[model samples]
Target: MSESYEKFEGLIPGDGHPRWGQSYYYNAYDPVRCLGVFIRLGFLENQGEANSWVIVFRNGSPLFTRTNLNLPHTLARPADGVEIAGMRIHAEVPLKRTRITFSSPDCSFDLVWSELHPLADCIAMTQDKDGAFAREVAHIHLEGTSTVTGSITHRGEMAALDGKGFRDIAAGPRNWDALLHYRLAWPVFDNGMAFCGIRGISTAGGSAYMRMMHDGEAWRRVTAIEDRLTFSPDGLAVEHAHWVFTDELGRRHEMTARPLFGWLFPFDTFVLREHMMEYRLADGTIGYGLHETGYRLPWQGMAD
Candidate 1:
């Protein structure tokens, strides 16, 4: 399955839209060490530059962060991998295996991702009168769960990481300011169940994209999602969240999220608050992954 679309598309000719871009995001968490890392590498060929955002967390606080929005980049995908700002994401075997590496004055890492499941395509079902899919979220988006193992050296202290992780790649025209608000969750359970869902509101309308992979089963599209969330006093972070996803087979799967720690990344249009959450299923199964929300700026809290 990966043989078809795993290769990077690089920058394709667009309709001269400034938002034409391609990006890849990779995340890993070491449950034993309570450490996690998030990396987003993006290229805006129309603008002739790229962006690299890397954040490392320990015990719920940011240990290291690097955000470079203005950096030289290549117009096409390099044979080795997508290298920018001293970071690289190379596909060792398309979707089956990948190698990620980075180096800096204070921190460096070499991690390998081995997929536990095949890549799942996020096909949006909601469309507006103008026929926009997921409010034109992305032309192509794919996500999956994996087993990550590597070593990270920070401040001369090396830590061996072995745990679960998640990754996604997206490409096409994307306007960061198009959405008024959004909520997303991707939890990979220890029992082999994984879910990836999102609900976003835009001027066009509300859009939903959901997919889940059951243990030893193929990915299934979720028909509907009932999302509920609780926020901190500042409304900038999530206290907890509950969600009921209805799969195509008419089965309801419920899950609860309790955030362990969170970090914020602010953009001109919105502030992305991301948390490494501890998740619990109705059946008492526990897991870990990312729970993220996007709110438009000026610091207004979550809508009532």
Candidate 2:
């Protein structure tokens, strides 16, 4: 079957409403350690401001919260004092051909969208002393507007921002109307340490899909897996799967994916899920990184 791109309506509760948007990133190292960061950006219908904040999480829990700062920015680690931002940020997502120029007394930079694709978005810009880094952005578009305003309250923390907007979509309280986007890098060990790009999608109907770069190959749709999913007591989950991919060459490649870690988020309408799977050839050889899942997207301007 061809790759399915079915449209979903109200997949997210308050998509396209006037409110701040939040993006999160989580990184998991080989053995048994992981770190995550949550970013909140204010968005209005026709206005833009400098109100953005980021929260860090480690080992499936909260670590620290940084307010009024640029995202993917370096932060000091409390454990070893070693810089982890370099590994934490994979890529930057853009806001659909949008550009933002920021100027301060000591520094200034321009955020421009250099690439736009159906799977991921890239925003390119230069920071204070750093040369250039593209910010990869992703989000779950909601369906409606909110009634509250000023300082978004998420996970019991009050975020102060420069705009008047309500809860475009409820962030907490475990509602199901939410969408998710996950990005990660896959290292292909068999072919001279070659790496492939992988992404996942999660939607409302409990349906998910994974897209990845297949050794300079085109996008392929995975049909099924050979294993079951395992859940942890703390809500962490993992699984190993064998996927059957049909590529553009009209050939099928059977690859085994050993999941290193999984990230789970509770949504309003559905439970969002993502897993970092290590792809390997059927003969027990490492191939690439496979990030897979799906999410519901808010539907707008649709005719019945």
Model 1 error, position 245 (Å): 0.7
Q: How far out, in Å, is residue 124 in model 2?
A: 21
Estimate, for each residue in 145-197, the C-alpha lDDT of model 2 and write its tens digit: 11111222344543332210101111111222433432333334444322223
Per-candidate Cα lDDT values, in order, are 0.77, 0.31
Best by lDDT: 1
Predicted candidate 1 versus true structure: per-residue lDDT over 30-144, tens digit per residue: 8899988988877777888788798888888887899887888576453257777778878877777889899999999999888887776664322221333333556667788
Worst 10 residues of 1 by lDDT: 125-134
Residue 238 Cα positional deviation in candidate 2, in Å, after optimal superposition: 2.9
Instruction: Provide the lDDT at 17 for model 2.
Output: 35
Candidate 1 Cα deviation (angstroms), residue 30:
1.5
* Model 1: CA > 4 A from native: 9-15, 76-79, 124-135, 204-207
Candidate 1 has a TM-score of 0.92
